[model samples]
Target: NAGVTQTPKFRILKIGQSMTLQCTQDMNHNYMYWYRQDPGMGLKLIYYSVGAGITDKGEVPNGYNVSRSTTEDFPLRLELAAPSQTSVYFCASSYSSGGHEQYFGPGTRLTVT
Candidate 1:
């Protein structure tokens, strides 16, 4: 609650299943981002929002959708999940974008079988 927090630490879904990965921050950051980390690979941005009511796609946003209805919440929705969607998802928040310090959540491990 003090920083970024993510729900459902771990989850497993069969092919075609869908889920929403929840994220929240108490720091009231205006910049929020979502990223996914695959095994042995660096994190790839899925989506980002500068503030509530403004959202944009990132490096890898094909299978994901995000909405920032409020400053505290940014949820990632995985639609028609596939095996390639399996990865560790991270949520981060910062007062400003680019070079600013960011607070990251513990992450949610999602496995799509």
Candidate 2:
């Protein structure tokens, strides 16, 4: 199974532009998360969903939004692209949050010019 997948491996956007970063999992995981990794910094959670129709804000959710309408897809939407939002984005999924292993997708590198 394709554990987790992210589309548009790389993207470039101008200020004020908007885009959607797609993420999908074939593992039927119950937990999914979005995270951003800035240069020289650890990954910071942007948003997460425990299951379908249940979503929550993470460490950094400003300028972004997410929805979990199914167990296989969780997409991240950037309302207004900003330079500060330029970073590598990762999508991960886990069957459970209780010490279970999470499968991560190949990161999507975004640059805002």
Candidate 3:
């Protein structure tokens, strides 16, 4: 099984263009998260979902949106792409939030110009 997967490993978009980054996990995890990592910094949480139909914004949720409609899929959407949104996005999943180990996807590199 694919522990976690993200589509379109790399993407380039215009300033106004928009796209959806797909994330899926086959581990049946209850906690899912979206994080963005800048060129030379740590990962910043953008959004998280405890389970289906439950979602919350994280530290850096601006310009992005996420919806978790199933136990396996959590997709991040960029409504109006901007240059500042350029970063490497990662999708992670874990069984618990209390210091449990998390599984991460390969990541999606997005470039907005």
Candidate 4:
């Protein structure tokens, strides 16, 4: 399986710049998630999708958006970056196999200056 992949492994943004974090998987999983981890903090859910054409807000969904139109691509949009958003962003997905494991991507280290 190809699993999940993210682009632009590292990025630094200004106070209000915008960017998109791309995530794609090839494992035919039905659930995908986006999370952010601060300097020394645990993972905070940003957004998640049960399947294509369906999406929902997570714990920390502010300043972010997501879409899942197919079974493979799920991208995260950062409308206005902020210092508070300076953290490591990770994309993860899990199969709907009755509480299966969540596989995480490498990560996107974002810095808001």
Candidate 5:
């Protein structure tokens, strides 16, 4: 199975543009997450869902939104993009929330101008 995959490996947006970073895992993991990594900072959780139809904000969900319509898909939406949102975004999943069990996607590099 293809562990985890993300689309549009790279993107550039204007100040107010909007986009959705797509994530899908064929592993059928129940726990999924969206995280952002700045230049030299550790990853910060943006949103997460324990299962389909149950979503919650993470450490940095202010300018982002997420939906889990199925166990394999977790899409992260960036509304009214800002420079502060410029960073590398990652999509991860795990059988449980155990950090060690988590698997990450290739990552999407986004730039806001």
Candidate 6:
């Protein structure tokens, strides 16, 4: 299994442009999440999906959206990117929230101007 994979690794954006950061996991996990880690801070969840066809917003869901059309993929869509959105985006997946350590991809570093 590929665990998880994220595209671009790094990107720069202007004030109001938009982009989508791709994330995929081959572990067939039931839980997936998109989290942003700002400099010197804990990760804030942007969105989460418990399973295919089921998704919910998380703590810091603003300027972001997510969709889980399949068990292996969960991509984060950033609309109207802002400088505040500049941070490292990590795609993580777990078998269960209580008993599993989340597996993270290499991360996509986005710089919104």
Model 5, 1-113: lDDT tens per residue? 89999997999999999999999999989999999999779999999999999999999899999999999999999989999999999999999875648999999999999
Listed in order, each prediction's TM-score against the native is: 0.97, 0.98, 0.98, 0.95, 0.96, 0.96
**What are the per-model C-alpha RMSD values against the true structure?**
0.8, 0.6, 0.6, 1.1, 1.0, 0.9
Worst 10 residues of 5 by lDDT: 93-102
Score residue 51 of candidate 4 by CA lDDT: 96
TM-score of candidate 2 on Cα atoms, chains taken together: 0.98
Q: Local distance difference test, per candidate?
A: 0.94, 0.96, 0.96, 0.92, 0.94, 0.93
Instruction: Score candidate 5 by lDDT.
Output: 0.94
**Cα lDDT tens digits for candidate 1, 1-113:** 46999998999999998899999999989999999999789999999999999999999999899999999999999989999998999999999987999889999999999
Question: What is candidate 3's lDDT per residue for 14-97, written digit by digit as tens?
Answer: 999989999999999999999999977899999999999999999999999999889999999999999999999999999988
The stretch of ten residues in a row with the least summed lDDT in candidate 2 is 1-10
Runs in model 1 lying further than 4 Å from the true structure: none
Of 2 and 5, which scores higher on lDDT?
Answer: 2
lDDT of 2 by residue, 16-85 (tens): 9999999999998999999999978999999999999999999999999999999999999998999999
Candidate 2, residue 109: lDDT: 99
Relative to the true structure, candidate 1 has a C-alpha RMSD (angstroms) of 0.8
TM-score of 5: 0.96
Compose the digit string of candidate 4's lDDT tens values, residues 9-87. Answer: 9999999999999999999889999999985679999999999988999999999999999989899999998899989
Candidate 6 segments whose C-alpha is farther than 4 A from its true place: none
Candidate 6 local Cα displacement, residue 85, angstroms: 0.3
Model 6 residue-pair collision total = 0
lDDT of candidate 5 at residue 58, scale 0 to 100? 90
Error of 2 at 91 (Å): 0.3
Report the Cα lDDT for residue 9, model 6: 97
The 10 consecutive residues of candidate 1 with the worst lDDT sum are: 1-10
